[model samples]
Target: MADRILTEEEKAAQERRGAAGGAQRGGPPHMRLGQPTEKSQNFGPSARRLLGLMAPDKVLVWAAMAFALVSVALTALGPKILGRATDLIFSGLFSKQIPANVTQEQAVEGMRAQGETKLADMLAAMEHIRPGQGVDFTAVRNVLLLALALYAVSSLLSWTQARIIVRVVNTAVYRLRRDVQAKLGRLPLSYFDSQPRGELLSRVTNDIDNIAQSLQQTLSQLLTSALTVIAMLAMMFYVSPLLAIIALVTIPISIGITAFIGKRSQVKFVQQWKSTGEVNSIVEESFTGHELVKVFGRRDEVGARFQAVNEELRDATFGAQFISGLIMPMMMFVGNLNYVIIAVVGGLRVASGSMSIGDVQAFIQYSRQFTQPLTQVASMANLMQSGVASAERVFEVLDAPEQTPDPAHPETLVDPHGRVSFEDVSFSYTPDRPLIEHLNLCVEPGQTVAIVGPTGAGKTTLVNLIMRFYEVDGGRITLDGKDITDLTRDNLRSQIGMVLQDTWLFGGTIRDNIAYGRPDASEEDILEAARATYVDRFVHSLPEGYDTVLDSEAGNISAGEKQLLTIARAFISDPALLILDEATSSVDTRTELLVQQAMANLRQDRTSFVIAHRLSTIRDADLILVMEDGRIVEQGSHAELLERGGAFARLYAAQFAGALTEDAEAGQGAVPRGVPVH
Candidate 1:
């Protein structure tokens, strides 16, 4: 069975299992759903390319940086300004009361005569310029107002900065998603066949979403953290070089601890996402094939398998999150330790009068600011790693080679005779192993060609070649004396109609589906096609008749009805060539007979190639080819092939030995008795 993608319910269940908070490293929820693993990818290339994605928004980036600079500058200066306020309060409120007009000697004598000896002594030490008596409320108010203004302006600029950054990120990812979508159209069918649908979906949805989220969250933090660290360090140095140097010691220590913890987490991050994808794959498979699983009584086995993957996911997520989670707390510990050290040393300096109390306070604040960003930077490392990994995946799709080019000068067939000829055609699914070799065939207009073969005998592959789903490896296939390769694939395909064993009816009303092959078909044309294929019999039975909507899987319709719908679709197209591979396999004998009659009528003037394992279906075919492995072992009419007693005769006997005996008992000669030519 073709691998199907996860359904909405399964995907929703996976999401419910994600961490209540979010994925580690700011990746998608899928990343958080898997178990911890050991893998790492170098993000240098993706990172450079990510920056290239942002290259278009250079002006906005510069604007954001400018705003960040202003915000950081104002924020960094806050401590120093607060120190000034402290100095103003200290100088204004605590000075001894003495008149500026009175000399110290006179003040001292007056105080002594009033019997205030402490004041008299303080006055004796006072200089000619007397201390003020009242607080400097006006000066203090101005300083406070200026500090408040700086903060207000800083906040405004920061908001503006955030808006611009958001714009830049949104635009970058918009372009990225657009490129990925465009790349999808350019990619070949082989790419889709080689990759899982869910995996491709994840690349387009989950991975791209993760990249956008990582950018919005981490990019903002990254820019702000960088500025905060720089501003803090500068202020620390300006306050006291000794304290600044002392605080710098914590940088290497914090970084070493973070790097040690973060590196291990980063390695697990890639593994985490991969395991998550694996689990999702299992869920998708089980959900899509739940019916088969239940019918085969494999529910317990499938459940056990799901439980094992879930356990793996839980373990990996715990390991990655547990390791990465230690970053901030450990850095906080180092920061607190550094804070204590600075406080003790600065206290000594203050005691020695080398630094003021206010400077020491500001320095301590600066130390906290400095270490805080160091911690943040270490955390951003994880997010950056995952984002870059996601970018690499998206880029891989975008970078895939495009489909083979169409011919510059294409050939066309006019008044076509529906003649299909395969001349020395050769093809192999793999390059080293040759499958079909120098195969030759000729089909006349309005002839029914039957191809009967065992499993793995390249039945579908041969038909695929004629449809140009795959090109012939060695020789050319021609239609009406013109090489198919010389014609544009689109033009060649327009002339052929196909109905496969697996009926596909997309989500739409009954009429809409029948008209899918010929969008411009009128209602009358659709009704006639439906009647021809016996689709209208059941379609009219529905409550909504032709207006009834089909589900995505089209399960609302019976398998037989679905098959009839597809046949009707092919009939509506009314192409010159018809290819049917077990087209009536889904229906009962009665419906199959009806469909066969309909198909016979449809094939009246068109060349038809019928692929069948049932000998009854192709008994009256104009020409029958019995294939073994990849070569046709027998080719003849029904009576001729039976008379030869070759592979065709053997296969026919295997399917209807009793019928053949009955025919001979009835004196019917060598012709098969199960089915007769009409």
Candidate 2:
């Protein structure tokens, strides 16, 4: 089958989709970052996993459920007891409180006419009561006292449920976080390299917090709502099945209305957020590039676009909110329609002597209870989805494939001479899209070897292989005749040291940052490392000396000084092999000279690999390797390569020729001082 060419728009959309997937791995924060994850849960699976989290502590979960059931049941019972009190008060008024000659309504009207405080109180007591043969204050008082007790018991049980569930939620979240942290250590470096830190951070912090809060707050409400619905329906049926069916009619109608409105509102919400984000981007660009806009004479165009975006955003926001807001009132209207039907029909039943007024009152309260929970659940559906999404994100980390396993019987390097070799190793960031292939190299013990190339020539990739940051797809790498993969990563890495271009320093004292690799390092050991790396000079220059704290950015210190601190950190580790990738790339010539001298001293008795863009630093290496496309194009000392007039010779001429020419013109220096720092 012939593959059809994609349209430009289709191709662009595919690229955007790819970018979005990449963003989830690691990306810059969007204003409403949570919005995507909130709606992104595999709802069915995540909800099952969430419930499963509670299953381990079955005792607490069951206890909480039991208490929740009791609380809601008592709450349901309260309305029925209240209806009985109304009946009792009416009976008492008709029999004992009202004048024999007066109608019940007339007595109430007379009391209002007199406006006597005591008489008004007597009238109010029998306002809904009807005349009866006798009244029983004893039974009424007993019923009221029982209600008070049930209410108290309900409150206590509800509080107990809250207390227990909160503990369970806390414990679950704690374990979840612990599992994530442990999983991070086991994850392959490729996972982190491909993904963004923001995604992981959100999972670790925001997502977990959402799950915890939702479980604590939503779960209790969800349980109570469920029980309330059940109890209300049961009470309604017992009072009268005909009215219960009428109340039941409202359920599907309310749900249907909610689902319809909810679906439309969700669409509007997505559009609104998209429009809002566009507006934000426009506003941000307007301010950030104000000077450019003015220079280009496009202020009016910018203003016109901003107005259009703002108008669209306003329309969407209003539309979404209006539709979502309709749920409550539409539900209320349906409820009221049900209420009017129940009251009218029950009154007729009472007149027919088939039902009592108290039962009608009780049934009305039961109907409210039934509808209230449905309304609450409808409102909470979004929150539940948001919570489930968070759980899935957290679980994603826990479920990621870990690093490749070490050999069952691993080899060990007893006295590592740091003789490193790569034999026909192959690997790629993407499958079949080879970044490095069939590459081979070797370094002798105590040899200072330099690998230099243009950007993307696989110099750093080679170093990464030597350090085993990623496992090679084929062939092997070895240290002192032992296969690197046959040894555990910790053991392999313990023998190697690396200084990368990017300097990472956390928030801590300068001393702490320097001693990060060896926390138990003695002051003497730290000072020795610092003095060797020329970090002592800067540390002492600060008023706080070594105690000076570095911020997360480490902006208080110069970039060169921060780089030196990292060199000191590596020095403190005292590994058998060293890999320096642009170690002095950030420093000035003078500072670079100082670092070179320190590095020269450090590499005296250890095998070292240096990856440099600058040719001047590594001319004196025992061997020089020129790399292109993951293969060595030339291998020799400086003189040999210059004589051969190959890739390395051309590279050398392009970079250091001016320095050598300048030195020659001054008649004070020659050969670009290529050999040693001092």
Candidate 3:
């Protein structure tokens, strides 16, 4: 039969047994309830720290900025060149002796009068005129060539700037991902236990990618647009300050609109990211527990729950993007209005002869060039804000406090003789309630110590304390006269080996799993360890023997075989202290016997602690301690405990009463009702 799942009543009964045992060991209540749905809102410090990571690449960044300036300068210069050419053409056309508008006969008469006047003036000053005084085509050609050169240079500079921006952004993203991964690795195990794996994965993958994308767009567009606008505006004012002022009126209005939309968009984008994490967490949990859902026939319900989260994410993202999208169009609208105003005013100025037609044309062109980049800058605000949000998420993990290492001057433990002792050890999961209270216990090396009690009797807590998974609240646990707290955690744990009931195997071949505990172990040593744990039989039964690859978590293997493999792993460690908590509970009677025999061989010279629910397994233990609550209620040999007729005797009787009666009926030797098996 499968081992019974511990009920609340059974757990309480075991606690009572530990209490009656007079030596108590306790622990925090197990947390079986689902975690609550809440999100954190701590992005300020994380943002600051993320910005600091960019300090090293400032030089290349500045160089990119310089190229951007040159590109903008040339872009603005293009319109001024057209304006100058327009002025030259307009001057030549308007200088003729003709009215702004006239009939054909009047235009002909005017042209004939102007030609006669021009010929008379030429006759009067013909001697003063020289051949070299005609138009200079060379100078005109030089100016056109300069304009072409400027266009080419601007295109090259813009391309180089884009390349540099992309390079910098990608490099920064690479470093950020690396730092985030490293930080996750250093975080305490408790943090992982408390947080959802999907949430963490989302932060590393989705959030970082968002930041990278935003950085890519924001970096290139924002820098290029800002520089272009500045250069364009300068040229605009140089052509006609009045027209430039008229167009400049749009700047403040555009800024105000952008700022308002950007602020609201940032809030929505944060919500979007939070919703994404929630959806990811739900999906991850559903996929991981697909078997459970299938067994319970709740696939539709699960799908509905996932759909709810997915819809929430979709709504949030749409809201954020929609709001951010408004900035560009609004800026463009204001820009077009300013463009009309500049054109009207400049046209009047040119008509009144206050400015040349070329100046009006150039001013209009410069206004358009300036407004285009301004609109681009306004649009990029959303990308910049999104990147900032991602940076905040990434930095959150990087800034979290790491697990503190032991002090530099830790006391060394030498030649530990495995005399385990807990002196006044106390602990709690929460400050309000204590789990263990002034607990004490002692066991010598080479002793077979059996810890018996109901579920949650603090049996596992006691072992966790020895391994330093957590530090004691108010006392010390010593091994061989050395305080465990004084030794490095790694050093303390290195001396112990454990085999838990839940065996986990990474995806690999059978030989890899067996050799994990001692990577350098020879084939003979691995075989010996496997033999000691009787793992060889199951391993050899596989079609490919040791070369067979196990499924993820070793799901392809039987529970009993997996348990045996774990035992083989611990046996290979050859630790001074060994712990077996429900180690053989999953196996059948025959497999249990084999495992028990192998365990007996492996524990011959080591200090072993066995926690068994089956009374028969601990019947031959050198010392059996019955626990109630968190204390030992009885301690003695199996026979001595039976003679006491206490908790141990009652437990033994409950497990094997039918067998004892059968033996009695068969006329074989049988002990009394309260007598323990020996």
TM-score versus the correct structure, for each prediction? 0.82, 0.80, 0.79
User: Deviation in angstroms for 441 in model 1?
Assistant: 2.9
Clashes of each: 4, 4, 19
Deviation from truth (RMSD, Å), model 1: 7.8
Pairs of residues clashing in candidate 2:
25-195, 25-196, 26-196, 90-129
After superposition, the stretches of candidate 1 with alpha carbons farther than 4 Å from their true spots are 1-38, 93-130, 188-190, 380-382, 399-403, 407-418, 480-488, 657-678
lDDT of 3 by residue, 440-549 (tens): 78999889899888766676667767777656788899988888877887777777877877677889998888888778889998999998888888877789998889
- Candidate 1's displacement at residue 7, Å, is 25
Instruction: Candidate 1: give the clashing pairs.
Output: 34-313, 35-313, 35-316, 36-316
What C-alpha lDDT do the candidate models reach, one value each?
Answer: 0.76, 0.75, 0.73
Indicate the worst ten consecutive residues by lDDT in candidate 2. 1-10
Which candidate has the top score in lDDT? 1
**C-alpha RMSD of candidate 2:** 8.8
lDDT of 3 at 207: 87
Residue 429, candidate 1: how far off, in angstroms? 2.1
